[model samples]
Target chain A: MATRSRALLPISFVVLLFLLLYLGLYLNPRHESDDSPMIGKLAPEFDLPDLIATGDRFSRADLNGQVSLVNVWATWCPSCRAEHDVLMRLAATGEVPIFSINWTDRPDSGGSREAALLWLGRLGNPYQKTGDDGENIAGLEWAVTGAPETFLIDVEGRICNRITGPLNDRPVPNPENRQEVRNNVGNIMKTVRKMVAGEGKCLTQDS
Target chain B: MPYSRFMNGLIELNKGLRMMQKQLIKMVYLLLLLWAPLSAAAPIDSLIFETQLQEDRFKQLVQEIRCVKCQNTNIAGSNADLARDHRMKVYEMMKQGKSDDEIRHWFVVRYGDFVLYRPQIEARTWLLWGLPLLLIPVGAWLLLVQLRRQRVQATEEAPVVGALSESEQKKLDEVLK
Candidate 1:
């Protein structure tokens, strides 16, 4: 009996180690979905050259007094291409105006402003104003990590939510129940509606 | 004469093998000498700081900050455009004479704690910091308990000296008589 229990001890230890390793598969060490520190803070300021209309500037001041989305995108990013159609659909809804920042179109990333303009011209232009961030100056101010990241700004120009990755509409599969998962567009709209209703307050601030 | 020729061939072979071994050692040493400078070479050379201290701080800051796009590598080690922008931002802030804490705070406000390579000790990371400490003692105790149990079992299984069974004792007494 002692020998059996002794044998079981190492086996249990191995089982525990495996369980911990298995748990790690589901654990993301990165921040939680809604845990972006930029959320609820004043959106970063930027003044950039317009992509389509040369000699025109798109500034953060224009975002004041309205709910809007600031989308960071680049011709170099494949995910931006994937999310372009969803952005077009969102634009068609006219729920909110979107401002675009074309990031890293300079020589290092092998992207050019001309390519960005041609891309928008071919795909329908969904932006109210498109900022050409060839030097990524505006991108640094906005703390943009990569393209296809969208920020929702409230009426006061405070950032409400930051949606990382491409705007996806695929239904999340559920084996237990076949309920459709809310797509990125749907989620954005829901938040926009709430903000429009004057309920979007800064989580960090008392006001 | 044939035997002597064979002996000479063996000695030549031995000399050739030694020469190859020396060449291998020399190659390894050359690689070792080359590796340090290659790894220590700065990633970004565009930003020129006014002072050496400021430049050192910039180097330290980049290593501490994780590249969000790359996930695994720090901004210093990553060639991602975002990392470049981040490095520029850090350099700009350092030029502005912002303290290290303030610069770190600026990133934390934008990217969250995930941006930091060394996460602060907080409510969320308690388990991350404490788990290894907890596991060490638990693992040691389990090992000790197992070892003790194994010793006990070994003693029980082994035949004891001067302790015979009843039949064996009777046979022993008859032999003695």
Candidate 2:
């Protein structure tokens, strides 16, 4: 019995060590891409002036009673430019309305409403309404770390999932975006279709 | 004539001295007027505080909160735009009469516990906060067990002190003879 217990100790210790090492490997790269704590919480409220259509306003009220996408974009961010095509395609699908926050388009940040409007005009206006968040007040309230972060809001306006990087159609040529573009539509459309089907669920990490 | 001349010179000197004193006081008042607006005016950032305590709280909060855009740099140390926004956010919340804890909760909710350098003792973080304390007793117990084993071995290996060996006793008896 003594010898048997003694043999079990090192085996258990080795197993525990492997378990810890496994967790370390998984946890190390995750801090920079941590899951949004905003999941399952109500989307932060904002009343922003529209970017192009100057007289119009986009607020939390706009997102109400609809499962839609709130995208954070800035001309300064290159990833946002990359995601633009995907956004246009997504908008064309007419599956859901995409409300955009043209985040931090002030001169200091090297982005302006003109630049945003010009970009949208040249490419295509994919947004339902583009909010000019020049001051970044709404951006700050939304906890936007950087541009090209997209949030999926449920019918009740609770944040279901947040994609930290740009949505892409094909794999982005950049090696850095490999993790972000894993079968793009599978990440979004699968969950979106379910939510539209009245599942009304929030956690999409597994989905 | 000399007395009158001397008295007139003295009077002139006194008048000049009085004028100089008045000018000096006026200059002091002018300087004070310049200083008052600056002292009373809000700082360049307009982060004016009703009390020194609020300013200190703001200072403490920025120091403790991490800038989400940057790795490892606190909001106070970062020059990133997000950091500036967060600083403004801190100022705004403080102005709205939110306490430090409430302000911390605001950030934590938005950015998770990673935002705070000093995390709260919550469900997921209790292990992080409590493990070092828990180890103290565990380590003490292990040391105690090892020490007891060593003591038993020490007693067994140590030479008996109450009596000599038979050969040593014989040698002693012979010496005495």
lDDT of model 1 at residue B83?
A: 80
Please give, for residues A68-158, the per-residue lDDT of candidate 1 as tens digits: 8989998888989988998998899898899999988776787798889888999988999999889988877777877778888887889
DockQ of each: 0.56, 0.59
User: Which runs in model 1 stand beyond 4 Å of their true positions?
Assistant: A1-35, A169-183, A194-207, B1-44, B121-177
Model 2 per-residue lDDT at A191:
78
The runs of at least 3 residues in candidate 2 whose Cα sits more than 4 Å from the true structure, single-residue gaps closed, are A1-15, A23-32, A171-178, A199-207, B1-53, B159-177
How well docked is model 1, in DockQ terms? 0.56
**Which structure among the candidates has the greatest TM-score?**
2
lDDT of 2 by residue, A1-207 (tens): 988997897899899999999988887564345577887799988998888777889998898888888999999989888889888888888988898999998898998889999999998989989888999988877888888888889888898877777887663444466545542744577678888886565645455
Instruction: Evaluate residue A187 in candidate 2 and report its C-alpha lDDT on the 0 to 100 scale.
Output: 58
Q: Ten-residue segment with the worst summed lDDT in candidate 2 chain A?
A: A171-180
Every candidate's lDDT: 0.82, 0.84
lDDT of 2 by residue, B40-134 (tens): 53323567788998888988999899989995778887778888889889999898889899999999989988889998987988899999999
